[model samples]
Target: MIDPSENPELWDFLSSLHSGELLTGTIAAIEPFGVFVALDDGPDHPLFPGVGFITYPELSWTPFNEASEVLHVGQRVSCEFLQFDTWNGEARLSLRATRPDPFQLFADGIEVGQELQGRVTEILTFGVIVEVADGIEGLIHVSELAGTPCQGTQGVVRPGAYITVVVTGLDRQRRTVSLSQKRTSKGSP
Candidate 1:
């Protein structure tokens, strides 16, 4: 769907690209929301400097505190084309897609009732997010966090503090893990 009335050359160029295809580009800009790529084979964007774009979550398969920790401006990279971003007139790209998905690689055999040790990454009023595995963050709902006492808990869960939790649920398609601090066996790892 090329808007030929606009930048016909740009639209035509993007129209030819397909999902899952590998595209090479340089990191043109990094914003808090996403990273921009100036694709080697793509036309100049009328607004953004690059026609290829990657959101924060697509930057890596590893856990990163910030996008700059994983990627940098001017760095060359090969990303998988996800789709044409019609709203932004850009190609939605995935840097992590070029790499193996950690969830699919590791979560296939994970079962409920498994105990895991993870560092608390975020604390919300509803629950805390923990990383039981690299790139995998799951929620310990407030209901699940109740009645669990830990050295790290001084009446509250704090980020970067370690906690043991039991797997309560898994959504493979969504790549989310549900955990319960209350269900974990008393032990430390």
Candidate 2:
């Protein structure tokens, strides 16, 4: 929804950009939620200092603890236009779109049933998250947790514990990986 309070002309300017079109800008501000970019060719924002924005997930392909770890204010960057932020009246850009997807690279060499060792990054009631490759995490569903019918994952695993898992599924369309711990063993991190 386009914010009625914002300038309509600004929205028009942003709508002119095509998705995946490369846009160059300098980091104008860094907020907890995302970064603001001062696009080289854009109107000055009515409310903000810049008319370009990059959300945290669009900033990088590699996982990080914070946006500061990957970007900083005043840093120049080239980002692919993702869409127009009608509500915010800014250009939504993706810095990661300018780079190759790491998940695709990891999937190129692997297939189903391949056994890989990775650290258990998270454990949920529904599944366990294992980091099988850089920026890639596979979900081991609760049903696939153990060989024998399992009770729960309460004391089964903890974060940072290395475990071996079989690649049960690869969803290229969604860019997701699914693993199973049923026929595997716990290993060292």
Candidate 3:
């Protein structure tokens, strides 16, 4: 078998790449899990069609139903090198890292006690997750779901249902925003 190390061209090309370097590539294929990119300035990957790969979450900051919604084959894209995935033998790339974080923008304009309308995206045993904006989700804990103590989240809220909630806490460091649905007549607390 021919060893990759024996190919000085491929070896030197791969050795020159470093994490956090910016790269340009064309979308070679779109998959459910990620997008394969044929790098314009890098050696061809032995296992994949392209030398760079972007995972689903790395495609964009906005939530998308399909990879095609964010990228198409032959499309040129700029990505940040996350790491060399030794297991997959591909360069782990992040397209979103090259763009501004939407969560940080959302957090900047929001404050505690501010009211916002959102759709329930998920219901967990501990709380209900609401999408206040594109890709922005906040949790309404079971205790904050109602004025009175509740037994469970089943009857409280369902997925796809729209609800108004007041922000109770914000942890920018953790990228978490705590919301509450319970409100008194005056909306003081």
RMSD of 3: 3.1
Q: How close is candidate 3 to the true structure, as a TM-score?
A: 0.81
Whose TM-score is higher: candidate 2's or candidate 3's? 3
- Order of candidates by TM-score, top first? 3, 2, 1
CA RMSD of each candidate after superposition: 4.2, 3.5, 3.1
Q: Which candidate leads in TM-score?
A: 3
Candidate 2 Cα errors over 4 Å, as ranges: 1-15, 184-189
lDDT on C-alpha atoms for all candidate structures? 0.85, 0.85, 0.82
**In terms of lDDT, which candidate is stronger, 1 or 3?**
1
lDDT of 1 by residue, 49-126 (tens): 799999988888777888999889999999999998887789999999888778877678688999888899998767
lDDT tens digits, residues 41-151, model 2?
A: 888888886899999999998888888899888999999999987778889999999998989989998899899988899989888899999779999988777633465
How does each model score on TM-score? 0.71, 0.81, 0.81
Model 2, residue pairs in steric clash: none
Model 1: per-residue Cα lDDT at residue 165: 90
In each prediction, how many residue pairs overlap at the backbone (N, C-alpha, C within less than 3 A)? 0, 0, 0
Steric clash count of candidate 1:
0
